[model samples]
Target: MPTRRRTLLLIAAALGLPRAGAAPEGGYRFQRGLMGTRFMVTCYHEEGELVGKAVAAAFAEADRINEAASDYIADSELLSIGKVPPGTPVRVSPLLFGLLEEAWAQAEKTGGLFDPTVGPLTRLWRESRRRKALPDAATLAKAKAAIGWKKLVLDPAESTATFTVPDMRLDLGGIAKGQAADRMLAILGKHGVPCSSVTAGGDVRMGDPPPGKEGWNIGVRNRDVDRNAAELVLRNKAVSTSGDLRQFIEIGGVRYSHIVDPATGLGLTRPVSATIIAVNAATSDALATACCIADRETGRKLAAAQGAEVFLAEG
Candidate 1:
């Protein structure tokens, strides 16, 4: 086998599948680092070469999504929306337009708790975390002023996005990975690899169960413990976990999570983990973040309204 093929086949062995056990017989796994994290695709197919091609195509699709929607990328289509003059319609790719549509719908469903307009605040908190301090009142206030889901206008007919407020950046960190994983899974299915799972960080989108298994076994981690708090068996569904478990910083002996609550314009101070299971990865991913920011009862209600389930754990 060539070096590239060897590396693709070795990803399954080297990194190991998350507590889901080995891929079924005739399964092929591929992994690559994309969008600031590891993206793994495992598919069961009779032909090894075909599996390799399908996984490669899936990764390619993931890369495309990252290029189109990444907030971290200076020239991404998503960031380009911020560069346009305020209130000017900026035509975007159909993919980005559809994604923004979904995000807008999710924001409305969650009553602005899942706002993509939280980008300004996200950047501010990111800098604060790096410096091990909180943003000053003026800075936080400025960021908050730029937020508000209503300020985003999506014209479906023109396939454009318009920002009504200046500095109205969009951070899709809470939802973009799920969308990428969903697209990768679709790519695998189109390639005749239906029994597959795409794992992008904490987001997992499963297509069909392994050859003999009833469903994929996914482990949900607790906020405080190293071990998984729950093991779920699911198929043809998506699951995402968002929390401060590992992504947090301590300032003045108080820990703050990387997840910023749009309501407060600051990272969440409470140690909580939110897991959302829904029909698709994007819904689950965004809901997981919203659930983390909401109180337990409200979180459950929020997920339930969207035909999703929420599991909340606090340390």
Candidate 2:
């Protein structure tokens, strides 16, 4: 549950696009702390009360999804599955089961570049970061042994999941927030709020453009420049970026990113940042994590294969 913080930088307002509908007197924006980060929802509506109700409903949906997916929460459905004995099938909620299935598929697709089973390794790295030292070889080996998507079995019909190895754990941090954003947008849509945007950490999901604007311009922050590295226009699309610039540890004069490589059970060393733009935030979020682990060419190819655009910054 102690995941790396996102380097979102900024979500800029609409640029010089023409307003399409009757320009609302003003837009409504709300921000809340959720999922260990800031969640903001913005809508263009004539009535403040309507926007407020839609924002509340959207956030409530986000809360529900986060509770089910969060590993930090002891009673979360995900942790409940972690407590089950090896090879014991446990029925899970539709959301958890679907996410696990998606995680498995992505793990296979990316050659384990993005893995939910890396929770043990993630914990090891967190402790290593805390101690300001690298994890010993023996400890890394033990954690690595408990990781592998192939070791997890899912029964779709029964909606049951079983881990083949004892103590195997799952972490959805990479994709959960994006998934929550996607769901939040759906909730807003259900409330008849057509033009809106929801930002959960670095993952962003936007609906139609505000009034007459062509699209929302999301600024990608460049830590080195202390300004936006670039801007992406988004409408009915999502963007996610992953990097170690903001969340990492220094040990023995070397910097280790919080984004770990499951294969080596070690944090990434390259000064690389990957941004993925896809149809949904979940895909963008998970693929961005994959890009962090993959080589430059491989990451680009993977992103392209998914019909997503990728931008990688290597320093």
Find the candidate with the highest lDDT and give its number. 1
- In model 2, where do residues sit more than 4 Å from their true spots? 1-25, 222-225
* Cα displacement (Å) at residue 57, model 2: 1.6
- What residue pairs clash in candidate 2, if any at all? 18-212, 19-212, 20-211, 20-212
All candidates: TM-score:
0.92, 0.90
- Top TM-score hit: 1
Whole-model lDDT, model 1: 0.86
TM-score of 1: 0.92
Could you give candidate 2's per-residue lDDT for residues 1-315 as a string of tens digits?
A: 111111011112122111122222356666777888888877776654455567667777788888888888889999788787798898999988988888788888888899988889888887998889998888888899999988888999999989999779888888889889998898888888879988898899999889879999898863454877888778999999889878899899988999999878999888889888999998999999999899999999999988999988888
Query: In candidate 1, which residue ranges exceed 4 Å CA deviation?
Result: 1-24
| lDDT: worst 10-residue window of model 2 | 1-10
Tens digit per residue, CA lDDT, model 1, 1-315: 555445444643444322222344456666667788877777887765566667767777777888999998899999999897899999999989988998999999999889999999989888987788888899889899999999999999999999998989998888989999998899889989999999999999999988889999999886756688899999999999999878888898888888998888988999899999999999999999999988999999999998998889987
Clashes in each model (backbone N, CA, C under 3 Å)? 0, 4
